[model samples]
Target: MTDRILLTCGEPAGIGPELAPLALESGVDFVWIGDPRHLPEGTAYHEVVAPSDPVPEGRLPVLPHDFAAPATPGRPDPANAPDVIEVIARAVDLIMRGESRAMTTLPISKQALKEGAGFGFPGHTEYLADLAGGVPVAMMLASTTVTPPCRVVPATIHIPLSQVPDALTDRVLEQAIRITHAALIRDFGIAAPRIAVAGLNPHAGEGGTIGHEEIRRFRPLLDRLRAEGMQIAGPLPADTMFHPPARSRYDAAICAYHDQALIPIKTLDFAGGVNVTLGLPFIRTSPDHGTAFDIAGQGRADPASTIAALRMARDMAANRA
Candidate 1:
């Protein structure tokens, strides 16, 4: 049986619900896992069932769940938090059971989740790792252009800059590299990917003046990874690594922390950036942007990112299958 992609429109309060119809029209075969009530009135939908249901025709198929009171755009209700998480869990189960091939999640608001559901972890990456039985996961931001092609994995995610050094370790760096390399080959179809490791300090520590992490931790990891015959480079300066010419030299960039990796990619392709979680047993992708609370109900939400996410999810699922 061909695997259908599962798309979870996160919080109904955000743009997730709004972007559903556009994503459905993108020629990707997927099951919408959310409340049917959130979709535009009169929109045709089919209920998802156990033991694999046939793909519904002429309308987007929906795997419905009982969500809290009617959804109000831009205004999240704490009462609905558990229901939102339940949908995600079901989608994950579908993938694990081989009923689905991949998942593309719409943006979800963390604040709303915590207030609504008593959620833990900063965001999806951490939550997903936990859900998948504690496999270590790395978030990679990818774009379509191979000329100046870039894939970024931040070593220290969602933590303050002050805490980065303590978190940076030889094992962590090596593990991140392995995950990125595997994902490139498995999901992106790259073979023997060459990776560039960005430095933790300014000017890559300016010979250890700015930070010793470059001298003590990053350099050793680079040496080890290189000896292992991984086509890897750098403890190079972060600022210099992202320039067009520099980025063209490798398959992916491994950065020391969140901002180091994300800043460059977000600047280069804000609307098209896709967040991919590597090392999961199943393919999981999402729009790089978050739930746009400010413009939630205004019909001003741009569906470009979500569309890109669905397309990428389809590609990954096809490749994996």
Candidate 2:
């Protein structure tokens, strides 16, 4: 496996610059694809024309993509939006060409990008899917700090709570589970992953008193998959599935909506969570949190999540190789 991992400096005005210095010291071979000028002032970095260039200790290796306007901490400039988008594109190009083993991204502001460059995608996951020729994808948040390590996938993401039921169809749920199952085996090296499906309502619908989706939709799909030899469990109550004892029964929990899956993992390992895009053509991981605009240059932003992301990316790339 190639030792090089490409890092995209997302939202230059955010805490990405501040976190880069610490992530560089994570002992992972990586090159940051962004303008060095946007980095924190007085920080040491070496410019490299290739991803495979050797990085010296205490200094970062950079592949410069010049931003039009200078970054102001906590203040996003619309002018820099195009360059931020370009940085992501450039990283994808490198990975597609086999220049790097995998890519780990910093946080990006979707609203800022849309206002600045007329970007139309919802977020990085969608944008990456388009770049990879519209392949099916699922977002998986995994935490290494928790005992036994919990990984989760939201069946319906970036939608309102009221719309979750309508959006989460049998086809969508099946795709998410299939992709996550394959990723656990191929990327995490789990030969046969045990997946627990979470119920959408309280107490798993209290036996059809609170809701009926579990029995009508989730149960049927889970039964079919289980019969096919996939290690599957649930339509279990979301409340009980996340506890330590219950978590030990599965490799990942597939939730019906975004918050159902994320809240538990974030509460357990807020600083060590990694957002992984499963079923992409290439390995891609990001810090579970967003661009901390308020603490952009304050040097108060924690890099634990970014470091964990890099480590996970390295391991996934190694597993794939």
Candidate 3:
């Protein structure tokens, strides 16, 4: 397999086009997989037949995937949505076949994909899992700039907060921990990963005064995981777990839900957070932000997260190799 990273172009109408130029600043070996027509006017790009093809100096190597129509800034064309989905699939196929070692995905608009192409999956993570034969995976938002590099996994993600109580089961939490622990070893080179688990209710159910899921459901599971000799701590209160002193205790935190895991890392290093998918056969990562429709073509999109994602993916690919 070629030591190349495939970057799938996301929603054409979003900042993916302009951000492509910014991604070049990352200084990693990656080829863009999208329609050249969707790229910003005057952006220098080289058309390569495959990821293994040699790239010349200063030109972005592009493995062009044609779209249905030309892009208009900030307004998604439903016609191009199908092609947008196809580009991601193409990248996955390339990676799975060992044409490339890893892929860094640009942000996709789930609403647009659903409305335009009848996309059924909630987001890229779910769709990617299905594409990989329904393997279970967890979403990790990891900091690229933090001292200890705050890595977090949300037990219940993309679902409404109401669903989280029922969804954040021992099974779900244990799977996240196992996947993360294994990934830490296989993809991150961590010999024995330290993990912290967050509590579900306010003050970790306040000794079951507020909620019993933490007492009845989660603790027992955590105890079992601990007995297996994995380095683990807590069912700690989410409110107090991310302070500087607390963050230093573990390599990663398994939080109860989405915001519980995300808020602190975004607070600590907003511009450099990366969204990583754990438990996939191949490496995958993306910027921790979404399509900024308001600034799609304004040249105001921050490339820091995208750059971080590429760097992280490159490092992950190396670690696997």
For every candidate in turn, the CA RMSD to the true structure comes to 1.7, 1.0, 0.9
Candidates in order have lDDT scores of 0.83, 0.92, 0.91
The positional error of residue 214 in candidate 3, measured at the CA in angstroms, is 1.7
Candidate 1 deviant stretches above 4 angstroms: 50-52, 55-58, 145-147
Better of 1 and 3 by lDDT: 3
- In model 1, the worst 10-residue window by lDDT is 48-57
RMSD of 2: 1.0
By TM-score, how accurate is candidate 3?
0.98
Residue clash pairs of candidate 3: none
Evaluated against the true structure, the overall lDDT of model 2 is 0.92
RMSD of 1: 1.7
Candidate 1: which pairs clash?
A: none
Clashes of 2: 0
